[model samples]
Target: MSENVAPTASAPRSLHGWSTEFRATFTLAWPLVIAQVAQNALQASDVIMMGWLGPEALAAGALASSFLMPFFLFAAGVVGAVAPLTAQARGARDIKAIRRIVRQGFWAAILLAALLLPVVLQIRTVFSWIGQDPALAARAEEYIQIAVLMLFPALGVIVLRSFLSSFEATRVILVVTIGGVVVNAFGNYLLMFGNFGMPRLELRGAGIVIVLTNIFMLAAMLAYVLRHRRFRRFNVLIRFWKPDWPRFRELFHIGVPMGLTVLAEVGLFTAATMLMGRLGTDEVAAHAIALQCASLAFMVPLGLGVAATVRVGIAYGRQDREGVRKAGWTSFALGTGFMAVSALCFLLFGPAIVTIFLDPGVPENRHALALAASFLAIAGIFQLVDGAQVVAAHSLRGLSDTKIPMLMAIFGYWLVGLPIAYVMGFVFDWRGVGIWTGLACGLAFVAVLLVGRFAMRERLGLLDRIRL
Candidate 1:
C-alpha cells in the first residue's frame, strides 16, 4: 500500500512512448482476444446446432443459458481475482505469493460451486414462475439440469485460467479453447442429430456435449499447468490439495465483490433477455440472435479488459504510477477502437450477420430474422459505450478497486438502465427497441462514471491510498 517516489526518468514521457505502450498492450491483448473468441465460438456452435433443431430449441437454450451464465460469471469473477493477484505477485518477484493466490483460488472456486449448485438446479421452477411457456420451460429445465453437471469443472478451468493468463502464457489457452470448440461442435453433431447410430437427444444432447467439453477443457488446462516446462518452476501442482484458510479468506474478500459486480452487469442483460420473452417468441428469438452477435463482438474488448487487469496489476505491484496509467489508457483505446470497428460491421451488415444464425428456408424464422437485424443495429450504437465501460471496469479491477465499481454497476444497470427499459418497453410501448435503448443508457452511464473514477484517481493522486 505504500507509494514509492515516481520513477525519475526511466518512464516514457511523450506520445511516442504512449504509442509503445499501446503496441505492447495490443501484443498482450490479441492472444487473449483470440482465446475469448474461441470460447464464445463454443457457445455460438451450441446455438447454431440448436437452431437446426428449431426455434423452440434455440429459445430453450437461450433462456436456460441466460439463467445459468450469471452464476458462471459470478463464480468466474470470484475466482478471477487470481489473475490480478498473481500478476501483481509476479511483478513483485514473489513466487510464493503467486502460488498462494492460485491455491486459494481453487478453494474459492469449490466454495462458490457448492453455494451455487442448488440455485443452478432450480431454474426450471423459476422459469415456470416467470410465466415462460410450459414446453419451453421443460426443455430449458432438462438442459439446465445437465449443464449444472459441468459447473464444477467449468469453475476449475476459470481458476486455472486466471493463473495461466496472469503469467502471459495465453498461447496454451488459445490452443485448448480451439480444441474445445472443435470437440463441442463435433459432439453436438453426433448427439443432437442422432448420428453415429445414436438416438436424437436434441436439447438434452446439447447439454451433454457442453458438459463433456468443459471436463475436457479443465483436464487439459490442469495437465498443461502441472507438467509444462514453463510452469514447472512455480510448482503449481505440488501440494495441490492443501488448505490455506487465511489466503482463502483474502481471495474471498476480493472475489465476492468481483462476483457481485459481474452479476450486476450480466444479470441486467439476462433480465433484459427474460423481459424480451414476454414480447413473444419472435422477439425473444430475435433478441437472442442479436445478442449473440453483440456478445461475439464483445469478446474482443473483454480480452482487452483481461489484458488491462494484468498490465495494470503488474504496474501497480511495482509502484510505477506512469506504467499503470499507460496500461489502462492503452487498453481502453484499443478496446474502444476495436468496438467502433465492430459497430460499423454490425450497422452495415446486420441482416447478413443475422442470417448466419437463422435457416433461411424456415418460413417461421423470417420475422425473427428481420427483427434480429434491427436489434443488431441498436447493438452497434451501444458498442462504443459498452466497450469503454467494460474496459474501464477491468482497469479498476487491475487496481484492486472492486467495491465502488460494483456499486456503480448496480446503480447504472438497475436504477438507471432497467427503469428506462421498463417504461419504454411497457409504459411507452417501444417494445424490444425500447428495452435495448435502456441498455444503451445504462452502459453509457457506467462508462462515464467508471472512466471519470479512473481519471479522478489519477488526478487526485489517490491510487496509493486506494490500494491500502
Candidate 2:
C-alpha cells in the first residue's frame, strides 16, 4: 500500500503582501462554497417536496428529519475530523499521509454509522416518549424507520467528501450533490404523487426517496474518487479498500468529541422541533417552514464556515500562525457581511419567504404563515451572529481545538439558550419569536466566546503549541 505523505510547510506571514497563501485560500474556498450550497439545496428540496404533499406530510417529514438530524450532525462532525488532518497533510504535500487519513476516515465513518444504528432505531420510541398526537407520531415513526437505512450511505458520503475537500477537490461534491438533488426530486414526485405508475407512499414515500438519493450520492462520490487521477495516483482509492486500525484510532480521537460537540448543538434544535410538535400540527408546520427558510439562508454562512475550516487548516499545516488568524477573521467578516444581507432580505420579505412553502389564504395556513413569519423575523435578527459563531467554530476546528467549542456549544445552547427559549416561548407564551430570541442569545454567546478563544490562542502563540 502506498502511504500518504504530508505537504511541505511554508513560512507564515500577514496578508499584506501579494501572498501565495491568500491566492490559495480563495482557490480552495470558492469551490467548497459552491459545493456546500448545492448540498444545502438538496436538503431544502426534501422539505419542499414534502411540503407540497400537504401540511400533515410537511409536519411529519419535518419532525422525522429533525429527529434524525442530530445523528447526521454527529456523523458529519466525526467525518469532519478528517479534513483538518488532510489539509495539514496537504499543506505539507504528504500524499501518503493523506491517503492513510482518507482510508481511516472511511472506516471510522462506517463504524460511527453502525454505533448510531441502535440510537436511530430508538427514534420512534423517543418521539413517543416526548408525547405527540398519536397520528402524527405514527407518521413520524414510519418515516424515521425507513430514513434510518440511509445512515450508512449518508455517513459514507460525509467522510469521502471531507477527505476530498481537504485536497481542494470540491467539484466532485458539487456534481454528486446536483445529481442527487435531481434524483431525490424526481423520486419524491413519483412516490408522493403516484406518478408514472408508481405507488404513492406519502410521508413514507418521501423517506424512501431520501434514502435512494443518499445511496446514489454515496456511489457517485466513490466513483469520482476512484476515477480521479489525483486521488487514484495518490493510492487513496486502493488504500481505502484496506483497513488501518491505528489511523482509525487517531480519527476517532479527533472525531468523537467533534461528533459530541455537533450533537450538543444540533440536538438542541432537534429538541426545539419536538417541542413545536406539542403546539399542534400548525405550529409544527409553521416551524418547519421557518426552519427551512432559516436553513436555506444559513447555507451562505455555512458554506463560508466550511471554507474557513479549509483555510485555517492549510495555514495551520504550514505552521503559519499569523496566516491562520487572518484566514479565520477574514472568513468571519465575509460570512457576517453575507448574512447581514440575507437578514435584511428576510426582514423585508419574511412573509414572502414563508409563502414559498405555504399558502396564506387558508385559515390554518394563515396561522402557520403568521407564526412562521414571526419566527423568521426573529431568526433574521441573529443571522450575523449565527454566521460568526459557525465560522469561528470551524476556524477553531482548523486549529485542532475541538474540545472547547464543544463545551461552549453545550453551555450556550443548553444552559443558556434553551432555558431562555423555553421560558419565553412556552412559559411566557411569547410563542415562536420568543423561541428564536433565545436561539439568538445562544448563538451570540457562542460567537463571542469562540472568537475570543481564537484571539487568545493567537496572542499566546498556541498554534506552535499544537504543531505535530
Candidate 3:
C-alpha cells in the first residue's frame, strides 16, 4: 500500500519531451486498440448477420446484448484492477506482489461470474416486466441464456489480458482476439444460416459461436501466460491455486468500486436502449446501428485509457507525481484527437456509415437507415467528451482511487443523465435522438468533472498520498 517506493527501473522514456512521451504512449496503446476493435468485431459480426434476419432479430440481439453487457463489463472492470496493480508492482520490482495480484484476479473473476450467471438467466422475466415485445423478448431471452455460458471463460480472459498488459505484452492479446473474431465469424456463418450442413439456429447460433470464441481466447491466453518466458519470473502458474484472503480483500477494495463505476455507465446506455424499445422495434434497431458505429470508434480511446492506467499506475508506484501527470494528459490528448477525426467522419458520412449495416434495397430498412443516420450525426457531436471521460476515469483508476469516481459516474449517468433521456425521449417525444443527446450531456459533465478532479488532486498534493 505504500506510495513512497523508489523507481525500480530506470526513468521511463515517458518522462521526456512531449513528442517522446506521445510516441511511447502510442506504442503502448495501438496493440490494445487493435485487440479491443477485434474483440468488438465479434459482436459487430453478430449485429451484421442478425441484420440479415430483419429488424426484429436485430433489435432482439442488440437488446439482449445490452442487458447482459452491464454485468459482463462490470465483472471485467473488477478484474481489470489487475492491470494497475501489476504496473505498480512492476514499478517497485515487487515480483511477489504481482503474482499475488494475478492469483486474486482469477479468484475475483470466478466469484463475479458465479454471481452474475443467474441474473443473466432471468433476462426473460425482466424483459417481460419491462413490457418488451413478447415474441422478440422471448428470442432475446434465449440468446442471453446461451451467450452467458461463456461468461466465466470470458472473465478469465479479461484477467489474463490485464495481467499481460501490465508488462506491455499486448501483441499476444491482439493476435488471439483477431483469431477469435475469425473463429466467431466463421462459426456464425456455419450455424446461423445453416451453411455447410449446419442447423440455421439464428440467435442461438450466434450465442453458441460466442461461447466457443470465449473458450478459445481463454485457452490461448492461459497457455501463453503459463509458458511465456516473460511471465515465467512471476511464477504465476506455480502454486496458483492457493487462496490468500488478504490479497483477495485488497483486490476487491480496488475492484468493487471500479465494477460499479462501469455498471453505472453501462446501465445508462441500457436504460436508454430500453426506453427506445418503447417507441418500436425499428427504433431500437436504428439505435443499435448508430451505436455500433459509435462503439467501433470508441475502442480507440478505450484502449488508450487502459494504456494510460498502466502508465499512470507505474508512475504512482515509482512515486513520480510528474510522471503521472504527463501520462494522464498525454493520453487524454491522444484519445480526444482520434475521436475528433471520428466525429468528423460521423458528421460527414452518417448515412454511409449506417447503410453498411442495412440494405438500401429493402423498403422497410430505409426508415431505420434514415433514423440511424440522424442518430450518428448526434453521436458525432459528443465524441471528444466521450473520449476524454474514459481516459480521465482510467487515469484515476491507475491511482487506485475508485469510490468517488464511482459516485460521480452514478450521479452523472443516472441522476443527471437518465432523467433527461426519459423526459426528452418520452416527454418531448424526440425519441432516439433526444435520448442520445441526453446521454452525451451526461458524458460531457463526467469529462469535465473528472479532469477537474485530477487537476485539483495534483494541485493539492493529493496525488502524493494515493496507495494501492
Per-model TM-score on C-alpha atoms? 0.88, 0.85, 0.88
lDDT of each: 0.86, 0.79, 0.86
Could you list the CA RMSD of all candidates, in the order they appear? 3.6, 5.2, 3.9
Model 1, which residues run further than 4 Å from truth?
Answer: 1-5, 8-16, 51-63, 131-141, 191-194, 197-205, 278-282, 351-373, 459-462, 465-468
Ten-residue stretch with the least lDDT total in model 1:
1-10
lDDT tens readout by residue for model 2, 1-468 = 011113234444444433555465566666767776777777788888888888987888888887788788888788789888887777667788888888787777777778877887776678778786678778888888788878889888887878777777777777888898899989989998899999999888888888899999999888877787777676666745777777787778777788887787777787787677767887788888877787777777777677778778877776666667667877887788888998998899998889888867767688889888888888888888888888888888787778778889889988988898888889999876777788888888888998888877745454654333
Model 1 agreement with the true structure over 1-468: per-residue lDDT tens digits: 222233544332233368788877787778888999998788889988989999989999989987888888888889999988887787677988788788888878778888888988898789888788999988998898888878888988998888887877888889889999999999999989999998789988988999999899999999998788878678875786887787787777777788998889887887898789899999998998888889888999999999899888887776567777788898999989999999999999999999998986799989999899988999999999999999998888888888888999999999999999989999999999999999999999999999888777655454653232
Candidate 2: list runs displaced more than 4 Å.
Answer: 1-27, 47-63, 127-146, 189-208, 239-243, 274-286, 355-371, 426-429, 459-461, 465-468
Q: Specify the highest-lDDT model's number.
A: 3
lDDT of 3 by residue, 1-468 (tens): 222234434433335666776887898889999998888788788889989888988999989998888889888888988988888888778999899889889989899999999988998899899888999899898788799988889999999999888888888999999999999999999988999999999999989999999999999998898788888778886687898888798788888899999889888888888899899988899998888889889999999999999988887777666678788899999999999999999999999888898999899999899999999998999899999999999998888877788888899999878988888888998988889989988999888888877767655455655432
Off by over 4 Å in 3: 1-15, 49-64, 131-145, 190-205, 278-285, 358-370, 425-432, 459-461, 466-468
Please give the ranking of all candidate structures by lDDT, highest first, separated by commas. 3, 1, 2
| Weakest lDDT window of 10 consecutive positions for candidate 2 | 1-10
Position 139, candidate 1: lDDT: 91
Q: In order, how many clashes per candidate?
A: 0, 15, 0
